[model samples]
Target: MRTNGDLNNTSAAREVARIDIDAAHSYRSLAISEAEDDATIRKSYRPFLLSPEITSTDWISKLELSTVVKLAEEDLHKTGERLKVLVLYGSLRERSYSRLLAFEASRILFRLGCDVRVFDPTGLPMKDDVQHNQPKVQELRDLGRLERRPCLGLCRATWESHCRLQKPNRLDPPLRRLRRPTQGRTLAIAQVSGGSQSFNAVNSLRLLGRWMRMFVIPNQSSVPMAYTQFTDERLADPVEGGSRMIPSGNRMRIVDCMEEFVKYTILMRPHFALFGDRCSEREERVEKERKATEKARKEAEEKRVE
Candidate 1:
């Protein structure tokens, strides 16, 4: 039903043909949805937003769609309001490419009809350096609560906040890290640097995403030698030539990853998320902890009586 090119375009695979720059759509602001904010998102620090990741010569040229692309396109037809997405980036540089990539993903997601929120990982203390009471730490925790099912997004940077969500192994409170960063929500990760590889940050994110029980989208982006691909105002398409996974001229990876994420969030929300059985592992662990607490309480009572 789909051609190899279409498959390549959709999946997280690298290799294959190069898209003609002349034919590629000029980067445009996401105007595909009209959803407004339900909750107020006032912040003290201003977020940096780059309009066009790359300038386009024409406004109408397009990239060939993958089947996955069609799925993402289909999500736009839903009748409800836009999905809320929170994007987190990992860098703190003056001219951070990861930050720029966050802007790029946000714009595309905006075009796809999602109410996106980008979290700047600045001023937040390390996961170990500060207690959870700090305002910034509290902000991260409050934002990460998955009860509302908003996409808790992240870019390149420290995993301190994500790590906080991890409950200690056996002795750790099973429910202490209550917010399920990955469960019942949509998430995506992206990174960019002047160098040609920054997979470590994203790879770490994947580990955290899984540990947090999140449904992380399969496709991801890591723009290496990023300076070559981005101009002052826009992120230029990758030039053809690179390893298998990291394709050159792979600007579309961001779109592919985000589209898949939106598709999963919308399509799978009901089927995969809503009707799920509580994890047996968690239940068993909770029961064990309850027993331990009861035993400890009884022992303390006996000592007091003695």
Candidate 2:
């Protein structure tokens, strides 16, 4: 008794019901999977401790420490001196991923017994507009002179082939004046990308470090889709089933990079003074001075003969 239109309506209703049922089943599966992940995490809970001699772990809460590295008596620095690290970020955003990453790095470096200093670039002026007496500029330059190791955290913007200009690039003009005097100092680079993982920013930072006469460390970190990687101001642990398929899943990469940086700094600190002692450059300067002296002597002799 039903027309063709009524048949079509009945079929559409059945299709809608089927879709609803499937959606409910998908939601239930997702919930169960999340619960399993949580349970696994609880069962495998471990603290992340870098040094075995750590007596107090009151400062560590979020970072899960499992590995304990014990240094031999000969391997330890006899001076008991701590490595000084300077951390700089390129962004000024309130919720800047670069800043967050820098903070995370500072935490790791501190736990490793390094004196970490995070430079705030707020109120810093551009290179052209900067004055020598400016407080922020002086602070940055002082830190540059004092700290032997620098770690840069850069923010990658949306652009084709390259990222946009960053605020920290302004630091080059002042630091460049140091020239070869600051050569052989260690540098570490880290970057955060808003979209996918990209090294454009870190690559650019490497070039900058080279220009500044710093030795950029071999290990670098480029975090992808930074927004999802952080939870409650801390990097989310993405390790499930003891695997880190996602590049930015584990913060251990950053920890490893920092460890390498500290090692490099220790290795090169004793040889820093030797970097500026280039025999060739010094000889060239001496030759120029000798030529100038000879020319002046010739001029004086001609005047006496006349």
Candidate 3:
């Protein structure tokens, strides 16, 4: 039952006895005897010994099995339960129509039982080396690294943000990290347009989301003549120059679409819940196996010596 590493080393027998001994006195005596009789052996089998290079087919097979075991343990620990959504807005205008649209969308989602976070692009540095290490940028990076739930970003189409073309092979670090797909999280994009130009913005946002591997929802809103649509209070007044107002029918359509989008976002993907039971069970199993295997190998070696 001796393990391969221990088979060639005679001193491993006493070392194994020291490990397996239960009685305090017996353990003390064996430990002292081994330490006195085998200083070199103990040094060779130090606590920080490097694992042998795995080369044999059997070793490779065992490694693969261990990997599978690790993955299974990880999967069992993963629970599908809660969802987190992050919203990213591309516009930073003083009275940005896009930001207003984002806020409205957030409200809709909040009412529908989704945890929503919004990122303001105002202080976000342009994709460059100088700003990469900035604290705010790092914060953005950390948000993207969230392991438990997937984040969703909402960007508006504007000349300053969405409509502009990104350089080839040049990626913003935050965007790059956020785009990685996880088990339970999803990304959604919506484009808010000022007027008929929203059609173009919707297309731009779709392309942006697609490039990032986010699930692009076709349900997009383009507030034609968006400036006239909002009142000083930021509510949809939809009336401009004290003359024309967006038809109540069109306003209702926008509201309804927003509601549907919120619903679809929550129901779209299952959230990954943390599984404590599976994690504990797997840990216990690994420990039990390690102890048992070590015990059996030690006992077999002791019997051979006797």
Q: Provide TM-scores for the models.
A: 0.60, 0.62, 0.49
lDDT (Cα, tens digit) per residue for candidate 1, span 118-201: 666666665463365776666655555566545434332222222232112211112126435446555576655455555665
> What does candidate 1 score on TM?
0.60
User: How much lDDT does each candidate structure score?
Assistant: 0.53, 0.57, 0.45
Location of the lowest summed lDDT over 10 successive residues in candidate 3: 54-63
lDDT of 1 at 50: 25
lDDT of 1: 0.53
Model 2 ranges off by over 4 Å: 1-77, 146-162, 233-250, 285-306
Which regions of candidate 1 fall more than 4 Å away from where they truly are?
1-79, 152-181, 233-248, 272-276, 279-306
Global fold similarity of model 2 (TM-score): 0.62
Q: What is the lDDT of residue 154 in candidate 2?
A: 20
Residues 84-131 of candidate 2 have per-residue lDDT tens digits of: 667777677877767766766765655555555666677777786449
Global lDDT for candidate 2? 0.57
> Candidate 3 — which pairs collide?
79-273, 80-273, 81-271, 81-273, 86-152, 88-154, 195-224, 195-225
* Best of the two (1, 2) by lDDT: 2
Tens-digit lDDT track for model 3 on 124-178? 7667657767776776665566554345333232322344432211224566656
